[model samples]
Target: MSATPAGSAGAGDGVYRTGYFETRLAADPNRAVVWRHICDYLRRWIPADSDVLELGAGWCDFANAVAARSVTAMDLDATVLKAAHAGVTAIVGDCTDLSRFGDGSFDCVLASNLLEHLERADAERLLHEARRVLRPGGRLLLIQPNFRLNPKEYFDDYTHVAIYTDRSLTDLLTSLGWHVEHTFARFLPLTMKSRGSRLSFLVPWYLRSPIKPLAGQMLVVASNPAR
Candidate 1:
């Protein structure tokens, strides 16, 4: 719906861009239940009072539900302003470029179902900026769809431009100067529409176990080496 800077996902003139977002909006009512479970799972990595910055924060679902000292939810979609909760400071911007914020501005940088949407160059720039803006001991939490596992439906969405697996993602972050702290090869189901999404009660049990069934996503948590 909006013209963002070049090299960004879901912002350019894509055919599905118009109604695609609207579709997500329609599912928000039911998705809120899933968001709550996601927020709870996120708390294990995010400490209280830690400033959090969520990139490509579509609908601000996780941002709104997360508990932190401060939360900034940004996206290229203009809808973020309306979809974001009042508690969240929502802004519209290019995910690969974070020039508006100063260096060392946050304790955690979060991206959920976002990185696969960018080109490698753009994603690298985003990691660079994320590193530049995080304080010492900061963490970058990425919840990405694992193409290795969900190859069949990975490219179903027209916006996906990059593919990453747990190993590849770890290598990418390590080469980018961040230390891989933890990586879960299988974390959550691939799509929000999956049947597991409705069973929020099972989320806690699943995250604590090593064996994740029907898992289609990868959770990678990396931190600055400075700490």
Candidate 2:
């Protein structure tokens, strides 16, 4: 979910172009391996039989790798449909308005490197919408760049408009009726483009390591409380 300049084409203007995907985020087999490990780590919060929905699922990496009963990947980029793995349902739509999905339609909602692409208001709306589509006790998982940790490079991606630290993100989720379950301020490297991310085999070890080096991304897990 990259930001388009004002008066530019609708969603996916600045980003989501075929060139952006081909160049900025080139297809890498190693990325799939990284996502596989990430999905395994995330599985603790996401049951194997859970129905999952990934918002702004760029490349559908998590959607394709995660073990789930059902997986739906939604992004403004049409390329998502092509990136989706077999059995993964891909749709191009605005994440802020998930009206296409019924209330409590998902057991878990995942968003990675997405919220910052939206304006503050839209980010909040997306969060609320995510909550609406999640079943009671369902979880919302997020992996986002922590501005507090990477302030110098936080805005390196021109699409990033909103800033959030672990503290701020937890506060926002709690204010929106979510019970935050976990927060790791320094979970992963700031970007997949980082040199460290190239070491795919080391990712699983990194996830377990207490002393993470070059970590700038934050992971937040929140659950919907019973009504």
Give the per-residue lDDT of model 1 (tens digit) for 123-207: 8989999999999889999999898888999987666778999999999999999989999899988876745456777777877
lDDT of 2 by residue, 1-227 (tens): 73342444665553566545665676777788899999999989999999999998878889999999999999887778789999999988888889999999999999999988787888888999989999999999999999989899988776677899999999999999999999999999987664655788899899999988888999999999988
Collision pairs in model 2: none
Alpha carbon RMSD to native, model 2? 1.8
Candidate 1: regions farther than 4 A off? 1-17, 23-26
TM-scores, each model vs. reference:
0.90, 0.94
Cα RMSD to the true fold for all candidates: 2.8, 1.8
Model 2 clashing-pair count: 0
lDDT of 1 at 70: 95
